[model samples]
Target: MKRKLLFGERMLLGDGTEAFNAVIPFRLRGIFKEEDIQHALGQIQAKHPWLRAIITHDENNIPWFEVPGNHLPIPIRTVMRKGENDWQEESAKEWQTLFNYEEKPLIRFIWIKGEELSDMLFVFHHCLCDGGSAMAFLYEFLQILDHPSAEIGVESPILGIQDVVPAEILNNRRQKLKAKFIGRLAATAIKCIPVSKKAIERKNDYLIHWKFDKETSSELISYCKSQEVTVNTFLSAAVLHAFKKVRGNAAFNKVSCPVDIRRFAPQIKDDHIFAFGLMIVVSANYKINFAENLYAMQEAVERKTAKLNPYITMMVMESAHDALKNFTKLLKHGKSSNDCMFSNLGRIQIPHQYKEFTLDTIFSPSVIGPLGNTTTLVTSTFRGEMDFSFMGSEGYLPYSEALAIRDEVIETVKLQLDPIAVL
Candidate 1:
């Protein structure tokens, strides 16, 4: 089966020259055979059609995800693990490596071979999957890796826009007209907006990672509960506070958070490999202190989330196909308006231990692309500990400045939880 790329997928695919990659790194403490690893991946490939599909261009130059008859299995690249930081280094390198979209599947596996502790990086093109999908695959991979006979059901893939947007919305004539009109209007306005002829330079990209111990993580959760705010909101506030503290007036007041589309649309399954996502932009109210800002941000987040219309948003984007190039160009050349794209996957439900092996850690996934504002921070809790992956480029955000921001982010969160715990 095959289908044309969606608007978001088209933008991410670009010309397929540069990599827009997402790396999900985790460590396993046990003996693993290459045959078992490949078999597990093979089962995952069989369950999801996208896992084995390749990108092909049509006469109109539109990209399509097509399953080639006798398509090659997902490729694996294995290397010896030198230290704990090996996965981080390899993740950075993978971000710069382009996918052979026409010849192979969009996903690849990297096994960091070690005598007892093996760190694996499940790397894939951002156009092919999202954080939720990544986590789902990891859970399934771990299950089948331990029990090869595990019965994870197959996925009925979303082949077209129809599968994403509800049929009622697409069938209504009034909705169709509204979507077309708004899409065209937005496209025209985008074309008229002035942008820099040259894109912003983002040189020497890097990822800085850290984790909060289970005790500290639990304490922070309890603290958020007492404040009547979510751990996500509090963390957002702390992260923004750090940017302001480290970058001073140079930092943007805004942070963009991606909301999972599956929450809004039930047609999109948790296991389906899809990339579309809704977003909410947030900023602290400077007139209020950090404590007051948490409540304000929480309210704002809820109000915005409640108002989101995923069906309408999908309809509009689907109608805006002609403006794909201009929209992508605007993003690539647009002025930086936000400090960074931050996402909190919340707590991961995947089990950390199997009968054969122990799951050590699931590092927060990192994704980078050629689009505007390559800087991003992602957080997720696994095994009762919260982990973070902060990614940025030297030209956009210097490594020294990123280091300062990292330290400040941790300090700001600690100060909010407990001053005595600050270290």
Candidate 2:
């Protein structure tokens, strides 16, 4: 049976942000079979329902969703063919240009026929699935390609607005009163402060791409263990170091980190849900030693992570509806508190083998938008290495600055290991 799309799903579908992109490139040993590729694409579309859905708008500028039957899958385009050395360089540019998103299916497949091997690149928007979902979709695609009769599983459907929280409840008088009071408080706070001129002028237009070698990744993990801190804590500190150097502010130390509130309450863990989860604002005052400051930052993060309550985040989001209305004014006035965002998905586990295809490295590009450009540093450990994806707006922050921030992070880590040798 065809299912209806949820509000969150529709929001992503209608929004043209590149946040929902999943770029998967596969290297094949041999190719030249059109039928096999078509069959694989069919299976993929059948398994993932988002590919079949379309976005529509009403008179109010709000987005609505619809699905088509027996929808044709977007065909794979042949992009470029380059020799060994030029493959990566040529492929990156070609793939980015070809895979740009559209309001429709927004899925693209590219086949680059090389001398000894063939490369297949699959790009899909994030509205369809996240990292975990993308991995599952890729597995299904490969399985269908190798084995035609394979049974592909569909994702658990998103809950309609009425099913999870009734629309009437949102309009309840008591809830309205609470929202009003919270909104007033948020507005008053905004009026009391001035926005940072530097933050407003510094547009984030940069893209950061970095991968840690196995040895360096191991060392980082070991260091975290020895310090008795979570990998996120250590990573967050490293990010702060990068930001400090770029901003050149000794007192600039504030980070907002998203904490998944699922496990906080056992009852809600199994409920497949999507919304902004727990968010904690952390700050570190500039002090003497770098290591000591990091330790303090780690403690602050750990404490907040431990004490976060899901209900609190829900209440804050609900009550802050009024605050969202004046977000632009608050940001312009420099009342905005968070300098950056650190999101850690921790580790992603996929099966070692999926029928005929073996698992490869997974990359996740960080995403931030709608609000003032805030730097978001996303990290996910897969297979044995860490993949860091940094994403922000080109308007508020430049992409070149973001890349420089990443370089500073790696250099700082290296310095931590050999402080005496440098002198």
Per-model C-alpha RMSD: 1.5, 5.6
- Local accuracy by lDDT, each model: 0.92, 0.58
Candidate 1 residue lDDT tens string, 183-228:
9999999999899999988889999999999988988998898889
Number of the top candidate by lDDT?
1
Candidate 1's error at 327, in angstroms?
Answer: 0.9
- The TM-score of candidate 2 is 0.71
TM-score of each: 0.98, 0.71
Candidate 1 Cα misplacement greater than 4 A, ranges: 419-423
What number of backbone clashes does candidate 2 have, counting pairs of residues 3 or more apart or in separate chains? 22
